[model samples]
Target: MNNLINIFFLFLTLTTSGFSQKPTGVWDAFAFGAKGDGKTMDTKTIQTAIDQCHAAGGGKVYLHNGTFLSGTIYLKSNVTLYLEAGATLLGSANVADYPITPSKYPTYGGDLVTDKMFIYAEEAHNISIAGRGTIDGRGDDFNGPYLSPSFSGRPRILHFRNCENVQVRDVTLRNSGSWVQFYQSCRNMVIDGITVDSRENKDIEKSRHADAKGRNTDGMDLVDCQVVRVSNCFITSGDDGICLKSLSPNESCRDITITNCIVSTNASGIKIGTETSGAFEDITVQNCTVFDTRVDAISIMTVDGARIERINISNISVRNVKGTAIFLRLGARNRTYRKNAKAATGILKDILIENVQGTRIGGYGCSITGIPGFLVENITLKQIRLRFDGSNKPLLSDDDTRKPVPIAPPAVNHTVPEKIDAYPRGEMFGRLPAYGFYIRHGKNISLDNIALDYADDENRSAIVADDVDTLEIIGLKAKPSPNVSEVVQLKNVRNSPNLPKSN
Candidate 1:
């Protein structure tokens, strides 16, 4: 049986390797009157080349050594858009050039017509965008006045909907007005070795605010996707680095793997769902590094009535996190229910996090919280180390006495309020009572070989548990502080044999 399993894996590896080789029968864009000069409007010419290539039994459409200015161009089936070295596919500045179509998903209160994307593909199979060049969305020109109350007038760089057997590799994508790449309902997708720098554009500084240049410029948004693999990418963006969502009903985001990625962003580094209407399962994230993020390093939440289970995360290192290092929440924010249908609460269970380390975290420390009657169950944390800046001094104020002093006392026997309908965020519950971790309303939780270090002496406990059942804390180490009298505090906790008594 072992030998047969090994042979099966070997065959799978070989099949994947064979698929990476370039396709044959390349058709150059310049041969079809596509002037490579930066000044020419080559939307129609370049698209014609792609159409001819697709009509001729599907091959690579090559762009080489110049800038091809284009508007929205639809990708056909069995087509590969290859950008050679020193090549660029630039987005046109005019919004009217890209025609609009009605959105497939419900847009709540927003406009129905929102299909103005730079490079779009819908219901196409065997499609790819590969090679070592760049796709530059000249996003500064589309930052006009707001078109609707919910959405702006800017377009995304790449949008693929309902595409199967897709691959995107070894390209540089930058400066998108909205999300850089959005893969919605795509199956069997592979994204590898891509570099994304969607930071604020320096060429045209139109916004008066400092961070408003690339508003809503998320690096990658995968919504309702399945069988996806994202690896070896470097992303720096203004919004969430890599986010997964389930926006459609009756469709789930499942069987996804993200590994060996380095991310730096102003928003969450890796996140799942602020729009979870379907299930999310069988996800794994490993060997990733996140730095200089304004939000949590890893955030998992299912606030919109979805079941989240079977998540595994390991070998993560985070630094300079402006918010919590890790956050998990399960709440009741059912935004997608039909009229007159009863809202349902979600389920969260079977999560494992191991070999994680973080440094320089800000005020709202790590948290795992669930609503009143619904507990986050079967969570395990092993071989974890965290460091937080425990200074009670106000970050912006210089007054030393402004810092509140600690008062040692027994754990308060009070139940935390269940903010079921509030917006789900790491900082949604004001200032956390603990410095390292705060777990509330959980079941079957375990923490092993965990260490917490603080930079300055401060008043809160290193760990706190409230309303938890079947808790275990083994080999826990916290830095000694004169102000912090206790390392662990328990309130209304049951079956906690390993925890020390609070003073």
Candidate 2:
């Protein structure tokens, strides 16, 4: 040990010359007395190396050739932790190993998340984590219940709060107790070439019953951030795969682009807000693939008085979407996120989704709905093809097969509800009256070159538009059910183009 210490100082001296003016060099964890034996606690030594690197005006803290069990790595400014291929940074299972990281940013329910975090950086700039190593949060061993923003005993794998110029690339991140990574109120971030897998099983219902350890392992969350890029990634999780949330009325999630990625999850694959207190603008998502998702493959919502606008999603492929292909909702769920926070109905508008294809979707159809006065506006879907699993029309009595179709005018009006404050879901209105698309309370919606089909025998209209304005459909090709009298039903719709022509 004495010789090792002498060699370390000698190497430092040789690298730095007479003065300790090393601008950039690799700071090895082993030099700081870290035993990467997987059983020992190397957190302090690794943190010390990071501190030294930061103090020396920035360098890389190298961790290689071992498995390091650690907790709560606090990354600082201009510092980067480069993990080599043979190294692994494992999260400690003990709950007390993580500290409580406080924040002033209002989010989800405005309650503090039960965390510090496994890898935490707060108010730091020009920070990064790049490598080929694996970071395992070991979420399977964590015991807790997910009850919102205040649930205890679960910690996020990575949390970068109020930061700038953050880059996370080429790492395998998985098994978080809650959301795998949370980037809140950050700017100018790039997350590229990363792989994340946190699913407990292929089937969520069976997995929840089989393993009752942890909950809510979403893949990645970008909250109220701007100017971000995410590309060349693959993610699959127990919850939403990639999420954009806006939880503060003062800040909006804007200027984001996500491309060339693949995601699968038990929840929605790509989503924007269950937390819509702010705006989502200038976002583009293209060249992505989503599969094996239990909810809508793509879902966008504005429920808490925020504007969702100027968003584009193109060239997306989906398979085995258990709920629907797409869901857009503008609701008046004017619930407060925090104390003294007011709520109001928001606007959802100016969205374009084109060149999307999907198969093996459920009976919920593609729903785009708004409340009475707040209409979803200026949405367009072009060159989209989707197939839904057929459904039998619900009957008043199953014993009599000759019952009249329950999806008539009076029944259709009552089939959809105005659940203003409820969380948005494609199936929230239950089985829709349409088999292909259910559009209500919408304005200036144009569906062009849409091809829809069903796997089994369906008994509903191909499209149903209620309270829709300026509705237009071109080259509308669909397989209408034999029992349905009309292929498309329009109620209280005004300013629409000619009735759709079947291709």
Candidate 3:
């Protein structure tokens, strides 16, 4: 009888232990706040419950069809925040309640500072926040201070840093105080089927400011991250739509891709490097649409000495660009980098733009600027058609609005007036074009099919290759009207032996 009793007790113990080891759903079990009728304002209790769930074992924490007010939620690995349809996670308004820590600011620069976010995770892995629920950051609460004349605003709505294998999908993140979403130094990250909207304010000018304006409120910012992909997302805000950034002037950003996305408003559509302290390479942006932007539709710049190279932008359609359709500038300025106790600067190279189409370019069709020898090179513009409807060329600066007018070739011989000459002088019509096709100063380049159209009835160049080498034009076409000829013309003087013609 004693042996039998002991056996029965052993069996019970084993069964209970196995049952405890199984994954428990947070709501079904009282790990955080009591699964409260799923109605009460159980903020602290719910947070406590979530912490307990993480400590015990990773599992699913849920908010099902109710309004839940919360302050900073920390998520751990092997855990997921699943929200049922119509559920809302409202953020706390008091700034002090959400304390700042060493967090990342997607743009401007990086250093730890105090900030708040709806969902935040750092240095963790294998995590996901998925469902049909809405994560609302009551941006209006945090709006006053941010909009103050002196305020620079906070970072982003949702941020994840130094994490691996992260997934954020099917969530509506709206009215963020700053950028809608930001991912910094994260790897293997995927963001899909996300919808963000912040256009309620009608003050178009103030809404576009980098500070009180949308400021750094980009739709999605991927910073110094690898193996990152953003797809099927719609973003419209007061700032850039989809942006990729790196520590300017030094580090390299690789293996990043953006596809099948719609980005509009405020500023550039898809941008890389205004703060480029780092190098950007192996980047591909394809099948996207951008319009109604105040600045360049697609702009790549490194003024503070960032070495950018190996970028591939293809199958992009842009319209109504208030600035240049494509603007690439390598500033003749110095970037400050620390050595022993001082800072220094350098140059940039290796960029490409291909398969791009634009309509109604308010500025120039394209713009490229840099210095001598250490210039921007190996850039290509292929299969591109641009129609500039405006009469005035987009100004590079307030005083420099005179559009670059290409010199025409002799009418009788159909040859460029000047022979292939040396630096600065031969490029009197413009700067020495390096390896360009239907354009100028872009070097060692090729054009499969490129068209440049002007509505101002002024002359425009079909192809401008100033100071370049090894250029090939397979199918080149241009129409510089008689009236427009004084302002623009087409001439290929690179003297390459193999210039192919499709017609």
**lDDT score for residue 36 of model 2:** 88
lDDT of residue 206 for candidate 1: 23
Please give the range of 10 consecutive residues that has the lowest summed lDDT in model 3: 419-428
lDDT of 1 at 118: 88
| Candidate 3 deviant stretches above 4 angstroms | 1-22, 25-31, 34-43, 102-110, 143-155, 200-213, 248-251, 332-350, 392-442, 456-466, 469-474, 486-503
Better of 1 and 2 by lDDT: 2
Q: Which stretches of candidate 1 lie over 4 Å from their true place?
A: 1-24, 103-113, 144-151, 201-214, 337-343, 393-417, 500-503
Clashing pairs in model 2, backbone N/Cα/C closer than 3 A: none
lDDT by residue (101-180, candidate 1, tens digit) is: 66654332323455558898888999999999999888767774322212466878988888999999999998887788
lDDT of 3 by residue, 139-165 (tens): 655654332211233435687777898
Every candidate's lDDT: 0.79, 0.82, 0.59
Where is model 2 more than 4 Å wrong at Cα? 1-24, 104-114, 149-151, 204-214, 392-414, 500-503
Please give, for residues 1-503, the per-residue lDDT of candidate 2 as tens digits. Answer: 99999999999887654223344577888877789899999999899888888877887888999999998889999888888987999889988898766665544667554364788887899999999998888787776765442346777788888999999999999888788999999999999999997886566324232444336788999999999999999999878899998778888899999999999986789999888887899999999999988777999998889899999999999998766789999987776666787875698999999999999887666889998888999999999999887774221211111222232222333267787777786766766888888999999999999999988878788898998888998999999888888888888888765964322
How do these models rank on lDDT, best leading? 2, 1, 3
Q: Which candidate is the best by lDDT?
A: 2
TM-score of model 2 relative to the true fold? 0.90
